[model samples]
Target: MPLLILGLLVWSVPHLFKRLAPEMRAGLGDKFKGVVALLVVAGVVLMVIGYRGAEVVPLWYPPSWTMHLTDLLMLFAVALFGLGNSKSRLRGRLRHPMLLGVITWAVGHLLVNGDLASVVLFGGMLIWAVLSIFAINAREPEWERWQGGSVAGDIRLGVITVVVYAAIAGIHYWIGPSPFPM
Candidate 1:
């Protein structure tokens, strides 16, 4: 639980700092580009280790079906993540693809993991996603229609995301405990 909380704080604070504090972000960006990268990487590593370590204690078990549903939702979450990085129609439609991706990932995990630690981690992420979205929308000016890539590019990104999602799902059991019972 401590680990999970710490990881959440580490992960969310740096991300939010940039969003909420532009001056600090700019100063850091200018003064310590390498340091920022190191901090981000270290923070992510700690978060992953802490999250996996904390999962050992199950606060509660969700219905068996939720795992399957989570798997499906994760596909969309990953796809949104990939699409968020690409200049696709999806990005054009959703001004903030990364926020949408974070929302999807957080919500998906929340459905599958019922433990207190998982709740805190995913819940924090969900809240951050919502707040970040609102902040971006409030700060940025409304722009005209997005200049989406060619239809072919959209198709390519969709295919790539699906493949990446499938590969991750296929390897998940090898990386961690199987979410579904055999």
Candidate 2:
């Protein structure tokens, strides 16, 4: 539990620091990016170790209905994730579509998996995404909508979203814990 909590903090704090402490990041200058990268790598390693060894305590069982919700939500999440880096008009409306996608994905997983490990991992991610969105908004108050996103780009994003989402689902199925109900 300690490791899990530590990993979550390690993963999120560096990201939060840039928004929360601009002066600190400025003081660090160019090295700040390198520090963040190291922290992320360390955090990922800690999370992998902690999650693998952590005791599995069963929480409430998710209903079968949640699986359906997961399918739909994951589709939306991936599309939103793509929108984050895309020049689509849809991206213009969202301040941080990637973080929002993370929140969506985390919430969907939390709903479907009620074990202690799942709760810690997914819940921590959800918290981090929400906090990051808020911190980013606070840091950048001005919003400028991107102008003239071509319809072709939007269509291309849809194709990419479907292909990527399918690949992710296939990988999940191949590895284990198939998201779909048999």
Top lDDT prediction, candidate number: 2
Clashing pairs in 2: none
Q: State the local distance difference test value for candidate 2.
A: 0.88
lDDT of 1 at 136: 66
Candidate 2 structure quality by residue, lDDT tens digits, 55-93: 989998999999999989999999999998886768788
What tens-digit string does per-residue lDDT give for candidate 1 at 13-79? 7777766887777866566666666766776687777777774567888787888888778878877
Off by over 4 Å in 1: 55-57, 141-145, 179-181
Give the Cα-based TM-score of candidate 2 against the true structure.
0.93
After best superposition, candidate 1 residue 106: deviation in angstroms?
1.4
Poorest lDDT segment (10 consecutive residues) of candidate 1 = 28-37
